[model samples]
Target: MGRAPQKVRNRDTNPCIDEGDASLKCLDEHNYDKSCCSAHFQRYKNCRKYWHSVMLQRRGDGVRPDMPTAAERQELLDAIGGKPY
Candidate 1:
């Protein structure tokens, strides 16, 4: 018998992610002046970090909860056959 599909947040449309994207867009519109949009930049960083944690947790592998660094993110992207953005 076929099992029903489980529901999960759609990454592209998640509200938290959308907010992060909006914050990024604003920052870009302002010429990427971090001093001018530090709060928005911080929010985007936090949102992306949380999403990364959630994804690692869902992998069912023993992933640590330590704060991820840029190198770690690059490593993960490489392991997953993706290019670092």
Candidate 2:
């Protein structure tokens, strides 16, 4: 018989903000100049965008929350076999 799947709970509490608001706050707190602020903001924005996109894709595609992709499976297989791919 198979074991029952585990239940996951939502744990995040921080409110979401747009890229502009986040960057402005980060710049104010860090006292960054225009160029430095822009660069830092861009980095944060890109990271957030990528994370959001991945989350959306996962939900839209109906992928199992814990399932690994082909590349990940291959890596695990290689690791178990003690061989480099």
TM-score of each: 0.42, 0.38
Candidate 1 residue 34 Cα shift, in angstroms, is 2.4
lDDT of 1 by residue, 1-85 (tens): 7997633344432425455677778878889876787777777677666656655674556555333444665576579786322
CA-RMSD of model 2: 11.8
Tell me how far the alpha carbon of residue 8 in candidate 2 is from the true structure, in angstroms, after superposition.
Answer: 17
Clashing pairs in 1: none
Instruction: Count clashing residue pairs per candidate.
Output: 0, 0
TM-score of 1: 0.42
Q: For residues 1-85, could you state the per-residue lDDT of candidate 2 as single tens digits? A: 8997643222231112344566777778778656657765776566456545655676789965533443554465477783221
Worst 10 residues of 2 by lDDT: 8-17
Best-matching candidate per lDDT: 1
